[model samples]
Target: MRYADRLAELDSCMLSDALDNLGLPGAVAGITPIWQGARMAGRAVTMRTVPFDGRRSTRHLGAAALERAVDGEIIVVEQVRPEGAPPAAATWGGLLARAAVHRGVGGVVVDGACRDVDEIRELRLPLSARAVVPFTARGRFVEAAVGEPVTIGGVTVEEGDFVLADGSGVVFIPAERVDEVLAVADRLAAKEAVMAVALEEGAQPSEVLGRTYEEMLHDR
Candidate 1:
């Protein structure tokens, strides 16, 4: 099945559980979607950026990754900074959001900050980030690399890895394990749907979900 189709069938929770069942780690922490219903699923186009030093060359932050990304690929950016230091600028913003939409990019996930959130919301692109800052990337940072592995919120994302993001959060699926993860996620989603129906029909949550949840997780 197409990645988008598979993503439509699962949410971050289901995929995260699937990853856990497979003993994999892909749940990103501290990154929240910018909009209430924002969601995306696509291959990753990873990039890394570092705090700017006056002597180093500056490229339009994220330009390389955006330019190279194919349709339906989400940009995953990792901000490189000194340990314990927070970023002083936005790594993503409105212009990039518009550009990504125009290019048919699925969305963007930043391990740092984003700005022009109002404009981004108007553009209606799915975005997840650590914080919001008003500063621009012009002199605050530079793109260090594109199409490479980048760590976002403690999760390692590589180019072409499956990226699924929604209100619950973002999760990455290793490119090689996409099929396996999807299979388990599908099963879990089906079981969860059954449980949801049972609850609506007056079954107690603990009785219908608690015991069955453990059994489903361990099954197969």
Candidate 2:
């Protein structure tokens, strides 16, 4: 599916609620909001390995591989493991961002560090990462592979999985569960909307919350 279409289907509210329920790491609520230009959309090109290793034979797929993805395919890189000594250098940089833009890649999601923050912001490519650093990752590691299953933010994102993200947050909907999750999200959104209306009408906060909780449980 087109990235925009997936994004539109999931919508910002659904994505936000999913992140809230999933507790993914980088679904940051308040931070330096970089990708405010437009909401990015894409299927996941998941990569779980982290901190580009200085190994030979790493596939520096570079621009060609990046551009090869269908429109709205966001490069999703997952770290090999959640913790340890952080990668010494940035996994991606301005060059990749520029290349991705040309290729119509939706955005980039790194479970590790990324460099070229200023440049990336200037380019206006959506990026979600653990942190930013000045160190570079050239001659260190190559693409090594692509289209493999990778995990990030406690979510096991598979290749070809649908990814929907915006300023609110990112959500990974396993292909098998997309329809189910969307149905649940729609119901939850409706309940939340009613609760919001009650709150605006001066209903007690606790009552509103309690009623909402009861409704969610009943729906289940």
Candidate 3:
């Protein structure tokens, strides 16, 4: 799951195709990059937030996750949403983005909403989430757990898993299948590279794209 540099070399579509070839579930749905040119990959460290009660929390929402994460690791937050809770609570914001950059975090993926889109963009932090809301989580949500499995885009994500987020979307790689998926994705990327060159060399669309693309997807 520590294949950040290698994973970043490929796009989400290539990775999704690789996952399909392996018959695995990793493509996260309903979430996307919060800014233009967003992309990052790293080991995951999760933090879950729940509805806040009157009781005070010893630490802030993302503090524990950041404290536990190392360089080239991403923070995954599960912001649970239910009725009667704050209607506009966001799981991430500007401060967290700054802290993440300072902590050397590769990026952040939230299951729920995020705020401070402009500030986060200014910091150039890689943030991918479901929505961009202007509400604060302070009075509505509190950190409930860390380093635990949480759902992101309906996909259960665990600590130490691989996370790849980009302009297309986010995809979580199972910790055990990182090498397998990477190998297939690399092969597909190489084939596509050759195809691109052929198309540039005046090869007809049908000639260059015979059946190799579909064959590769199924033949693995």
Instruction: Sort the candidates on lDDT, descending order.
Output: 3, 1, 2
User: Which portions of model 2 miss their true places by more than 4 Å?
Assistant: 1-39, 48-64, 167-169, 214-218
lDDT of 3 by residue, 96-172 (tens): 89999998998999888899999999999999988889989988899989999998767889999999988888889
**C-alpha-based local distance difference test score of model 3:** 0.88
How many steric overlaps does candidate 2 have?
5
How would you encode candidate 2's per-residue C-alpha lDDT over 1-220 as one tens digit per residue? Answer: 5345745655655665654554432233321224464455657775544334656653543444475576768787754532665656667789888988877787887766778888888888888766677876665445655677766666677877776666665667777666555666667777778989999999998998886575463454
lDDT of 3 at 127: 92
Report the lDDT tens digits of candidate 1 across residue range 1-220: 7976787678898999998888899998678887778888999999998877775664578778889999888899999877777767899998889899899998999888899999999999999988888999888888888887888877788899999888888899998999999999988888888888999999987899687687676776
Model 1's alpha-carbon lDDT is 0.86
Residue ranges of candidate 1 with Cα displaced over 4 Å: 56-58
TM for every model, in the order presented, reads: 0.94, 0.78, 0.93
**Model 3: residues with Cα > 4 Å off, grouped in runs:** 83-87
